[model samples]
Target: MKVAVMGAGAVGCYFAGMLARVGHQVALVGRPQHVEAFNTRGLRLETKAFDETIAVKASTDAAIAADAELVLFCVKSPDTETAGAQLAPHLAPDTLVLSLQNGTDNAERLRTVMAQPVAAAVVYVATEMAGPGHVKHHGRGELVIEPAAGSRDAADALVAAGVPTEISDNVRGELWLKLILNCAYNALSAIAQLPYGKLVEGPGIPEVIAQLVTECKAVAAAEGVTLADDVDSAVRKIVQTMPGQFSSTAQDLARGKPSEIDHLNGFIVARAQAHGLSAPANLTVHALVKLIESKAQ
Candidate 1:
């Protein structure tokens, strides 16, 4: 399959590299430096199993997706609409656009700008851009995606490329669960610049994570989302599974780039207000991260 990865950051590059490794035609649309690196020496994929450079095409232009059969919409939450618009004119009619993002509504946001079939995916992966055109994987690469027109085929391709995938009917709840996890850890990791295990080792951090998860659950309940019964276990598993992994928000802050805190914890705070509920934990962390971001401006 011919695939295009929009906003080819760490997550995008990982998937693009995996597909390319399996002999698929993969093209990446990203910044100039990574594009140059990709064209020069391919993508350096560092994983626990092995490290290899996989050859793939790269370009700064969204038109790189012109012939793509599958389009991985991997831009950050804030760039969803703009990036969608950039790629809108280039997509084929039958292209399956899977949103591999943090927020719950990125696929919906993308739909406003494009007429292609869009699916929302809950991505469970720990990866980071170690450097230009390089993606380092920490652990767990699986996707739970909502069904779309070509979603099954896409899932088959992803599974064949070593990415475990499942098609679920309740992606809204899945998205909420992922959001709750992000709220529980992303800000704490960002503020402390610590990995998951080390962040949890801090005094009072576990209590704070519990409070954030509770607040997020309340907001999600108010929104009529019925999350999994074992969300707490899932929260605990992050530290065990990806002990050395920093939250994506942490990576963003270290790079002095904007984070999706507004859509993670901030979204909970906003929804709590709409439902006449209080989310002080989420509010506090959201404010703190926003303050840090403000200084970065």
Candidate 2:
């Protein structure tokens, strides 16, 4: 299948490289630097098993998505509407758009500006851009995508290309679970510029994480999302699983780039308000991140 990755960030580059490695026609739409690097030297894919360069088409134009059978909408949550608008005119009638992003509502937000079929997907991968056109995989690479018009075929193609993908009916719940995990760590990591291991080591930090999870769970429950019983455990396990990794929000802040914190904890705060509930914990961190962002300007 012909695939177009719309953002070409860490997630986009990783998945695009995977499919391209398997001989699928793949094009990555991203910033000029990364696109230039990819066009000239191929994408360097680094993983534990092997490190190799995979040649794929790269462009800075959203118009590159014009003939793609599958389009991975991998922009940050804040860019959902803008990117969707840019991609809308370029997409073919039968194209399938998958939201492989951080937050829960990206797919819903993307749907507002486009006519193509959209599906929400949960990504469980640890990847980073080691450099321009270079993606380093740290760990797992499984996906759980919501059912859509051609999701089954998309999942099959993804699986055949070495990406483990599942079509899930409970993607909302899955998204909420992921949100809870982010709420527990991303802001704290950003504020302190610390990895999960060190962040949790601080006094009262674990309690603060627990408070955030409690508030997020209340909001998720209000939204009628049935999160797993082990959601708390899942949130706590991040420190053990990704001890050395700073949250994406931390990475964004350090690089002077905007983050998806609004869609993570801020989304919890908004939904809590909507349901006549309060997520003070989430609101506090969300406000802090926003303050830092404002001060950086």
Candidate 3:
């Protein structure tokens, strides 16, 4: 299959590289630096398994998606509308677009902007741009995508390309589950410039994390999304498992790039307000990120 990845950041490059490794034609649309490196040599993928450079198509132009049968919408939440619009005028009639992103509303937001079927996919992976045209995978590469009209076929294709994917009926709930994890740690860790291990080792850290989890569960329940099993356990486990990890938001702030706080905690806070509920924890995190954003300016 011919695939086009809309945002060639860590997530986009990782999956696109996987597909290209399997002999599929994949093009990555991303920053000029990455694209130029890819065009000159090849896309470098560093993983726990091995480090290899895979040859693939790379472009800085979004219109390169015009002929693609599958388009992985991997841009950050803040760039969703603009990226969606850039691809909207050019996508093929039967193109399958999947929003492989962090926030919950990316798929719906894309649908409003594009006439094609956009599926929401929950991604569980830790990856980063180790260098120009280089994507490094830390762990966990699995996908739970919304049950869209073309989702089953898309999932099959993804699985064949070595990406574990499932077409799920409850992708929205899964998104919320991931959001809770972010709400509990992303801001706190970012502000402290600490990883999960050190973040949870501080005085009163457990109590603070507990409060955030409780507030997130309440907001999710109010919005009719089934809260994850043992929210506390999930949030706690991420620290034990990926103690050295910095959230994409944290990385963004550190690099002076724009963070996606407004879509993560801010989205939860907005939904809570809509349902006559207050999400103090989420609101607090959102405000802190905004403050950091101001300081970065």
Candidate 4:
């Protein structure tokens, strides 16, 4: 398959490198530095299994998507519309655009801007850009994508490339499950600039997380998405499972990049308001992160 990764950051690079290693034609559209680095030396994929450089085509222009049969739309939530528009005129009609992003609504947002088939995937991977064109994988690389036209083929192809992929009919519920987890940890971690373990050790922080999870669950229920019964336990388990890991929002704040708090906790707050419910915990943390972002600016 000829695959194009739209936002070729950490997640994009990891999957793109995997596909390229399997002999698929992969093109990465990302920052200039990443493009230059990949073109100079193949993308460095540092994983627990191995550290290898995988050859791939890299470019900054979104136009490269034109040649792709499958496009991995991996831009951040806020950039969804703009990035989709940039790729809209270039994508082939039969292109399968999978939104490999953090937020829940990115694929729907992309559909609004492009006529190509769009599908949402719940990504379960821990990766980061160690440097330009270098992706370091911590663990877990599996994807649960919504069933769509050609999605089965896409899933089969990805699984064959070493990324376990599944097509799920309940992808919306899966997305909300992940959203609830993010609402519980992301903003709080960002505001404290702490890793999960340290953040959970703070006074009354666990209670706050519980409340946030409860609020998100209420919103999800009101929106008619049935979240898992073990959702609360899942949120609490993150500290134990990935104790040293900082939330992505924390990493973004530390790097002076805009965090995705708006789409995480902020989305919950908005949905709560629409449903005539109050999400006090989520609202408070969302405001704090917004304030921190404002001060940083």
Candidate 5:
């Protein structure tokens, strides 16, 4: 299948490399640095299983998606509308656009700008761009996507390429689950500049995380999303599962790049406010992260 990865960041490059490894024609649309590197040296994928460069097409223009049958929209939350607009003029009528993004509502936002069918996927991959054209995968490469017209075939294709894929009727719930996890950790990690282990060791940190999780769950419930009963346990298990791993927000702050706190904790705060509630814990962390980002700038 011909595939196009819009916004070839870590997640985009990793999945594109996987498809390319399976001999799928893949084009990565990204920054000029990554595009140039991939065009010259191929995409370097450092996975838990192997480390190698995979040959793929690379371009900085969204027009590269014109001929693709499957398009993975992987832009960050802030770039969702802008990137969607850029791809709107070029999308094929039959193209399957899946939003492989962080926060929820991205697919809905895309549909507002484009006539293309858009599906949302809960991506459970831990990956980062080590360098230009190099994606380092820490662990877990699986996707839980919403069922749509072409989703079954897309899931099969992804599974055949070694990525575990599932079609779920409640993808919104899955997205909220991931969002709750992000709210529980991302901002705290960013504000402290600490990994899961050390971050959990601070005094009163557990209580703070509990408060965040409670507020996020209330917001999710108010929004009519059914989260898992063990969501709190899941949030706490991250410290044990990846003790040394820093949240993506932490990595972004350390790199002097903008973090996604606005969509994580800030999103909870916004939704809670709309529902006539407040999320003090999420609000505090979100504000602190914004302060740190402002200072960094």
Candidate 6:
């Protein structure tokens, strides 16, 4: 498969390298420096199992995706439309656009901007850009994608590349569940710049998490998202599963980069307004992150 990673960040480089490793032709479309680095020395893949360099095509221009059969759209939420629009004119009409981004609405937003079919996927991974053209995987890598017209074929190809995927109709529910967890922990983690384990151990942290989860559940229900009954269990599991983890948003903030805070908790707040419901907890988290975001810049 000829694959193009639309945003050559951590997730993009990691997945592109993986596909290239498995003998798929993958091109990473991103920043100029990253492209130069990859073209010079190949993408560095550092994982718990092994570390190696995998050579792949890298480009900054969106037109690099002109020949791609599969487009891995991995930009952050706020840039979804801009990124999609950049590639819109170049994307093939039959390209299977898999949104490997955070937040729930990226696929829909991409569909609107690109005028192409886009599929949503719940990304379950912890990856980071260690250096130019280098991707380091710290943890899980699986996907729960929604049932789109071409999703089965996309999943099969990803699975062939050793990427686990489950195609389902309840992907939105799953995305909301993840969003609930993010609203609860991501801001606090970013603000304190602490790992999940340490953050959860602080006094009143558990209470605040519970409150945030409750607020999210209320907001989701009002928005007609049918979440699983085990929301708290999922929330608690993130700490134990990724105790040493500083969330992506936390890492972004620490790196003085922009976060998708507006798309995560802020999205919840927007949905709350649409439903005529209040989401004080989510709104508070969004506002706090916004304040810190200003300082970060």
Best by TM-score: 1
TM-score of each: 0.99, 0.96, 0.95, 0.95, 0.96, 0.95
Residue pair clashes in candidate 1 = none
Write down the lDDT that model 6 would get.
Answer: 0.86
Of the two candidates 5 and 6, the one with more favorable TM-score, higher being better, is: 5
lDDT of 2 by residue, 1-297 (tens): 999999998988888888888899998999999999999999999988889999888898999887899998899888889999999999887799999998888898888999999999988777889899899988778899999998999899999989999998999888888889988999999999998889999999999999999999898888899884378779767777788778889989998888899999999999999999988999999999999988778
Least accurate 10 contiguous residues by lDDT in model 4: 228-237
Predictions: Cα RMSD each: 0.7, 1.3, 1.5, 1.4, 1.4, 1.5
Q: Give per-residue CA lDDT, model 1, range 1-297, as digits (tens).
A: 999999999999998888899999999999999999999999999999989999999999999899899999899899899999989899887798999999889989988999999999999999999999999999999899999999999999989999999999999999999999999999999999999999999999999999999888888888999895478999999999999999999999998989999999999998999999999999999999999998889
Could you give the candidate ranking by TM-score, starting with the highest?
Answer: 1, 2, 5, 4, 6, 3
Taking all chains together, the TM-score of candidate 5 against the true structure is: 0.96
Better of 5 and 6 by lDDT: 5
Error of 1 at 297 (Å): 1.2
Identify the runs in model 4 with alpha carbons over 4 angstroms from their true place.
none
Question: Model 6, 1-297: lDDT tens per residue?
Answer: 898999999988877887889888988898888899999999999998889999888889988788788889998888899999999898778788989887878888888888667888887777888888888998878888888767888898888877888898898998888788888889989888999899999999999889888888988888789984489899888887778778888988988888999988898889889988888878887898888889966
Stronger candidate by lDDT (4 vs 5): 5
**Reference-based lDDT, each prediction:** 0.93, 0.90, 0.85, 0.88, 0.89, 0.86
lDDT of 5 at 217: 90
Worst 10 contiguous positions by lDDT, candidate 2: 228-237
Best by lDDT: 1
Native-to-model Cα distance after best TM-score fit, residue 168 in candidate 6, in Å: 0.5
Cα lDDT tens digits, model 4, 1-297, are: 999999999888888888888899999999998999999998999988999998888889998777798888898899999999999899888789999888789888999999999999888677778888899987678898998887988898899999999888888888999898888888888889888889999999989998999899899989999774379677766776667767788888888889888999999999999999999999999999988888778
lDDT of 3 by residue, 10-105 (tens): 998998988888888888899999999999889998888879899988888888777888898999898899989988888876788999988778
TM-score, prediction 2: 0.96
- The order by descending lDDT is 1, 2, 5, 4, 6, 3
| Cand. 4 Cα-lDDT | 0.88
| Candidate 5 off by > 4 Å | none
lDDT of 5 at 138: 78
Q: Model 4 clash pairs?
A: none
